[model samples]
Target: MTKSVLVIGGSGGIGSALAQHYAATASVVTVISRQKAPTQNSWHWFEDTLQSPAHSAQCVQLALEQRPEVIFICNGVLHDAAAMPEKTIRQLDTAILMQRLHANVAVPAQYLQLLFSYITKTAGVKVVVLSAKVGSITDNALGGWYSYRMSKAALNMLVKNISIEVRRLNPSAVVVSVHPGTTNTAMSEPFQTNLPPGQLQSAANTAERLAQVVAAVQPEQSGKLLNWDAKALPF
Candidate 1:
């Protein structure tokens, strides 16, 4: 039987791809975006509580009523407005950084907690979030985009913790953080210069790879950070 799926931040490049890929198979697929989706399958809402826990929690609270079988959190941020950008600080746009943390790390973490009941008692439920390759604390060779990196790293931690807790609740459920690779999204458009062949993918291809990865993820591998190819990532 088909199950419900929710794509958080479905307005994003990779997130949009996810909506197209799964909407056909899922019982009902819903997307939450800042703006309305071009298709009728989604519903748009304002995400103003990006910095406050209570506000972010409210958004997730609303989603809980739908009881998504899988949730893909594709939200993120990068500061292009800073007068100076550094690998270590990124100019410390306090408001922007805080917003990034709330969106990238805290909001997803809270939603996992809020949606715990949906996946815990249900079978075959999955929660997937987009994490960046730079988020790996052990894998940070370039050493730039501090806020984005740290927030993703925190997201990984959140997934690991959730997986541990879910084992006691639902054995069929899996929660994982996936890096969708560098794609041709507005977020990455600025960095597409000097790109390597096949390294930069279209949103469609990124979505395809992500769907394949999600299809292949095993419950035994729950709590792990993985790429679209199913390879392991450093937490």
Candidate 2:
């Protein structure tokens, strides 16, 4: 059967790559983004943002119509034009922290809340939220980027909490947090220096790896934080 896939941040690097990859097998690939997709004809595009409650509602409405088998909440912001990650405690600012929280934590949680209703018990569904290894509280050996780390940690918690409820409602549905590793995207462009050789992967490569991870997930594995290689990350 042809799959129905939904990508929330379809205009971004990994999101676009996943949309392209899934389009080959999906009967209809729907992308919800604030910007226009480069390859407009490859998938159905819905111009929207999850910045506000109204937009979130619209997202749920659109997604309910699609009833996606695989949904990827790929939206995230790291060092955007308005703010960059704090290098030290003294550099931390409330405004920047709030922006990061809104983008990284609140927005994605809201999307998941609204979209969960459409996932039926009979249909096997997977929801993958792009998270970071830094989000792991137990893996915080190199502590920096306070706001970004906090936001991702909160997002991970949200995923964990949502997974419990989702499993109760739809046993076949799985919600997971994924760390895509360091990819060659605009988001990681400013911090690509001093990385080990072959550490940075292309968006297409990361997308393929992510797809494999998603495919390998089972309902019993819901709520776990998975690395690109499909190993469980420490909470």
Candidate 3:
């Protein structure tokens, strides 16, 4: 049984569900998010915008002090009131692209960097970053959603790089990117209309599947991108 877990972006639909799922079994559940997470007596909440290096470092330091065995980085942004994903080259905006990059890639990269030493030190540690299959360069047949796609692709590369580096220091560590599938979350709300019926999953269901994936992933699968069912996908 896992003793401790950390869920970044824990206020979001899937993140919150994952935290709650682990909280039932794990003794220590630490969550860091921009907004306050739902009240749970067993959980530790840290409000962090992830905008300042000093602030992020402080939160990560405190959280990692617990030596969480499982870590989930679920920070991502597909759209906002200011802009939706670009459907074509004509709709692409520099500001929007940068926003997506900062949220999807930079923020997670910062946390991974902060958590590096702790991850290497902990035995059998599992680090799962929520990535989208759309990020796969080899799987891009139907192209669009420029900013979101580009940012996720960059995030996947970051995960791959970190996995390789971490493996050298700690062979027991498992760090991989996972595509959580189309879950019923605010991030996927706008696009759910076209999804084939059963493709949309509840937050709880997604969390359960993600937890299973985390449990089953081995050190050999560290650098690959995995689907919801733990199948390896092309990078």
TM-score winner: 3
Off by over 4 Å in 1: 24-27, 37-67, 80-85, 88-90, 93-95
The Cα error of candidate 2 at residue 179, in Å, is 0.1
Q: What tens digits encode model 1's per-residue C-alpha lDDT throughout 1-235?
A: 3366688888777887777777656546666666644644444343533556576567666765667767788877754554223455636667766777876887677667667777788788888878877888888878867678777888888888989999888988988989888888878888889998989998988988888887788899899899879899887
Q: For each candidate in turn, give its C-alpha RMSD to the true structure in angstroms.
A: 3.1, 1.7, 1.2
Q: Write the per-residue lDDT of candidate 2 for residues 23-97, one digit (tens) a residue.
A: 876557888888955653867777775457787688668755776778899888889777778879999999999
The lDDT values for all models are 0.76, 0.86, 0.91
**TM-scores of all predicted structures:** 0.84, 0.94, 0.97
Q: Clashes in model 2: which pairs?
A: none
What's the C-alpha lDDT at position 60 in model 1? 69
Candidate 3 runs further than 4 Å off: 37-41
Clashing pairs in 1: none
- TM-score sort, best first: 3, 2, 1
With a 3 Å backbone cut-off (N, CA, C), the pairs that clash in candidate 3 are none
How does residue 110 of candidate 1 score in lDDT? 67
Sorted on lDDT, highest at the top, how do the candidates line up?
Answer: 3, 2, 1
Off by over 4 Å in 2: 37-39, 120-122
Q: How far is candidate 2 from the true structure (C-alpha RMSD, Å)?
A: 1.7
Query: Could you say which candidate leads in lDDT?
Result: 3
